[model samples]
Target: MKLPDPPTEKSFPSPLHHPRTATMIGRWLGIAVVICFLTGLFSHFQQQTPSWLDIPTRPASLYRVTQGLHVLTGTVSVPLLLAKLWTVYPKLFAKLPWPPSRKALGTVLERLSILVLVAAMALELFIGFLNTLQWYPWPFPFKETHYALAWIIIGALLVHLAVKLPLITAHWRATPADRTPIATHPESLPPAITGLTRRGLFRTVVGAGTLVGIASIGQSVPAFGPIAVLAPRRPNVGPQGLPVNRTAKDAGVTAVDADWRFTVQGPQELSYSLEELRALPQSRSNLPIACVEGWSQGARWEGIRVRDLLELCGAPKGARLRVVSMEKGGFYATSELPPQFASDPLTLLALKLNGDDLDLDHGFPARIIAPNRPGVLQTKWVHRLEVLA
Candidate 1:
C-alpha cells in the first residue's frame, strides 16, 4: 500500500528542507565573495596607477597570494552555492511582492538584480578559471571586461542583499532551533533538485578536491601557456640593458659577503649563513613575475629554492614562513606556501635578481621568487626565514 501523503504544511521543515551545513557555508561564501570583490577592485586600481601616485606598490608575492586565494575560495564555493540556490529556489515563487498593494515594480527590480548577480558570478568565476589556465576564449580584454562587470556585480549584490535581509535573518534564526519536524513531499521538490545524500556530499568533496589538486600541480606545470587575458602589455625588450652598480664607491654602498649572516626570529627563531645556504643544491629558473599591480617583469633567478632551504634547516612542516629583512629593519613579510610550491625547484631563495647581483633595494644578497606567485610572497631583503609551525 502507498504511504499517506507527506504533510504539505508543517510548523518546520525536514532535514532536507532545513538549512544545513552546506547552506551555512554558502552564506559565508556569499559574504566572502563580497569581500574578495571589493579587495580585488582596490588591488586592480592600485596596480593600474604609477609608482609616483603614492599608492603602495604591492609586492609581486602579495598579488599572487590574494588573487590565488580569491580564485580558490570561489572555486570551492561553487558546489555549496549551487546546493544553497537549489534549496532556496522555491522561495523565488512565493508571491510576497514589496508593498503588496503597490505595483510590481519592486518585484521586477529585485528579480532583475538576482539575475545579474547570478550571471555575473558565473561569468567571473568561469572566465577567471580560464585566465588562470592561460586560455582566453574571448576576443575582448578580460581585464577590461572584468573591471566593467565588477561594478555591475557589486551593485547587484548590494540590492539583492537589501531585498533579502529580512528573509535571511529569519532563516538564520530558525535554522538553529529545534521544532516539530515536517515530512517531505513530492510537491516540495526544488528545480534541478538533488537529494542531500551521500551522492551530493561526494560531488562536493570531489569538486573541491580537484580544485586544490590543480592548484597544487600548478606550481610545476609550465606549459599551462599564457592565458594573458588580463596581462598588461608585455615588454618588447629585456631590462633596458641597465648598468649595474659595481664598485662600493660608485654605488655608495658596501657589498656584503656570501658569509653574511641571516636571521629569522619573529614568532620563532632560526639563522643561516650565506655559505651554509649556498651549500644546498642550487636551483635556477626563468619565469615571468606577474604583479597584480599591473606590471609584469621577467627575470632569470638563481639560488636555492625556499623548499630546499627549509628542508636543509629541518624546519617543521605546516609552519607559517616568515622572512625578515636583512637591511637593518628595512622591510619584512610573511607567507604560507603550499607543499607543492615549497618543494618546487622554481621557487627559489634567489641570491641574484636577473643576471646581475642583487641590488640593495632589490633584496641585496637574496630574496625569493615563487612561481606564479604575486611579489608579496617573494619576500625581499630576506635575512631570516622563520617557520612558525
Candidate 2:
C-alpha cells in the first residue's frame, strides 16, 4: 500500500489562511502565553522562594487567583494556538530560497525558531493541562520540564516577534482585504467549504476559547461548578467542602496517637499535647486553600498564630521557620515559612477547619495556613516548627 502525498501550500485553499488572521490569532495566543508564563513564574518562585524576594502575606487568595489565571490562560491558548497554526501552516510547505544565500540561511533559522516555539508550546500545554488533572503519563519530571519549556517558548516567541515585526504591524488592524474573501486560485473561488469565511473562523476559534475557559475555570470558581465538566477538581468538592491534592493516605500520614504532641523548636523549646494546643488562645482566619493545581476555596481556619507561637517559644523577631510534617515520601512534607509569612497576623498553625476539628485528610492534628502562599507550602499534618535565624 502506498501512502498519500503530503500536503503543499496550495493543498489548503481556505480564504482564512491569511497573514492578518495569523496576526490576530497570534496576538491573542501571545497574550495568553505571556499571562501563563508570568503566573507560572510566580508559582515557581513561591515553591522555590529566593532570598532576595519576600512573597506577600495578604489577600490570602493571591495564589488562588494567580494559579487559576495560569491554568485559565493556558487553557484559552489552546484554541488560539490552533487558529494561529491553521492560519499560517501553509507557510510550512512554501519553498525556501535556494543557493544557500544569506537570506536562505536567515529563513532557515527563522523557521527553526518557529518549530522550536510550536513544539515546546504544544508539549508545555499538554503537560500543564494534564498536571491539573494530577496525571503524569510522561517519564520526564513534569515541573522541571514544564518550567524549562516555558523559557524556551518565550525566547522563541520573542525571536519570532522580532523577525515578523513588520508583517505583524502591517496586519495588526483589519484591512479591506480581510473583509473580502481571498481567491488565491481558481479552485479556491467557490468557498472551499460553505460559509467558511475568515469571520466565521474567528468566531469559531473565539467560541472554542470561551467554552474551554468556562468549562475549566469552575475549578477555581465555585459558582460555575455545575458546568465544570472539563475541570478535574471542583472548588467546593472535597474534604470539609474543599479539595485535596495530597491526602493523608498518600502522604503516609495516619491518625495521631493519644500521646502525640506538637513541638516548636526555637530559642525556647516548646511542646504541647493536642488538648494543650486547644487550650492556647485561638485566632480565626478566613483563608483559602489555594492549590498550585488551580483549585481553591475560602474556609474559616482557627489556630494559634505563628508569631504568637514564635513569641511563646522565645524566638527572635523576623525569624524564619521550618514546618515539619508527619507526611512521608513527598517533596513538600516540610515547608519553610519566611519571616513575612511567619509574622503575619493571619498566619496560623491551624487545628480546626471550618469550625470542626480537621479530618485526617485535611491535616487533622495541626497544619500551617498562611496568606498568599502556595497550597503545597501550606504544610499539612505538621509536627514541629523549628525557628531559623
Candidate 3:
C-alpha cells in the first residue's frame, strides 16, 4: 500500500504557534534552567568538595535553600517546557528549503540543536523528578547520568539560544500581536477552529507553571505542605519528624552494639564510648537536614563539635578530615570534610536530634551535622574520624 503524504506546517494553524509565543515561553524556560543548573553545581561541589574549594560554614541552611530552589526550578520547568514544545510543534512538519543554500544549511543545524535540546531536556526533567521521590526505575546510575545530562542539556540549550537569538530579539517585547485589541488585530486573531488568542495561550501556560510550582514546592517548603498534592515528600512526615531517604534497615544497620566506640585517628588517637560522647562539653546547633531529594526540615542538634574532637585527637588546625559511617552497602558511607568544614564551630558529631537521641534511621550513636552540607554527606551512623591533612 502507498503511504499518504506527510503533514505540512499549514496542517497545524493555531495562531499561538508563532515566534512571539515561542520566545515568551522560551524566556521563562531558559531562566528556570539557569537557576537549576547553578544550584545543581553548588550541590555537586558540596557533596564532592575538592581541596581547592572552600565552602563556607555559615548560613547553616544554605544547602537547604539552594537544593529547594533546584527541585523547584526543575519542577517549574516541566510545564514551561511542554508549553514551549507546543508553541514550536508545527515547525517539525515544515519543509526545509531545497538546493542546499547557506540559509537552508543553517536551518538544518538549528533544527538539529533544537531536537537534541528537547530530547535531553525532556528526559532530564523526567529522571530528575523521579529522583526526588527516591525512585530509580531506569537501569543507569542516576547520579552520574543525571550530572552528565545536565552539561549536555546546557550545551544544547546554548546552541539553541544562539540559533534563535535574532528571532527572540525581534519578538522579545510587546507588539501588535501582544498589545492590539484582538477584535481589530489580525495578527492576534483567534483561529477559525481553536478560538484562542496569543495572550490566552500565554495565560494558560503561565497558570500551568504557577500551579505546578505551588503543588510541588511543599516538598521543600513546609508552609505549602497541605497544598503540595504533587509533592513526593512531606518535610516533617518521616522518622524523627524529618524525611529519611536511606533508612537504617536499607543501609543494613540494625542497631548499635553496646561495645560500640567512636574513634579518631590523627597526631594522637582518641576513642569514646557512647556515654563518654554524651559527657563531652556539648554544643547545640539549629540546622536543617537538606537532602538532594528536595525535602528539608529544621532541627535542634546537640553534639560534640568536630573541631573540638579534632583538638582532643591532637589534630592540627585547618586539617582535612574523613568521616566513616557504619552503613553497609552504599556510597557516602564515608565522606570527606575539607578543612573549612572540619574547622567549623558548628560542624558536629551529632548524638541528639530535636532534643532526643537520634533514631536509628536518623543515624544513631553519632553522625556528622555540618553547616551547608548535603544530607548524604551528613554521613549517618558515623563510627570513626581520620585526619587527612
Q: Which structure among the candidates has the greatest TM-score?
A: 2
How far in Å is the alpha carbon of 324 misplaced in model 2?
Answer: 0.5
Candidate 2 lDDT over residue span 200-300, tens digit each: 66778899999999998898888888899999988887889988988899999867999998999998899999999999999999998888888888889
Question: Ten residues in a row with the worst lDDT in model 1?
Answer: 240-249
**For each predicted model, how many residue pairs clash, with residues at least 3 apart or on different chains?**
14, 0, 0
How does each model score on TM-score?
A: 0.47, 0.95, 0.94
**Candidates, ranked, TM-score:** 2, 3, 1
Model 3, global lDDT: 0.89
Give each model's whole-structure lDDT: 0.56, 0.89, 0.89
Per-residue error for 206 in candidate 3, Å, reads 1.4
Which window of ten consecutive residues has the lowest lDDT sum in model 3? 179-188
Which scores better on lDDT, 1 or 2?
2
| Model 2 spans > 4 angstroms off | 1-5, 181-196
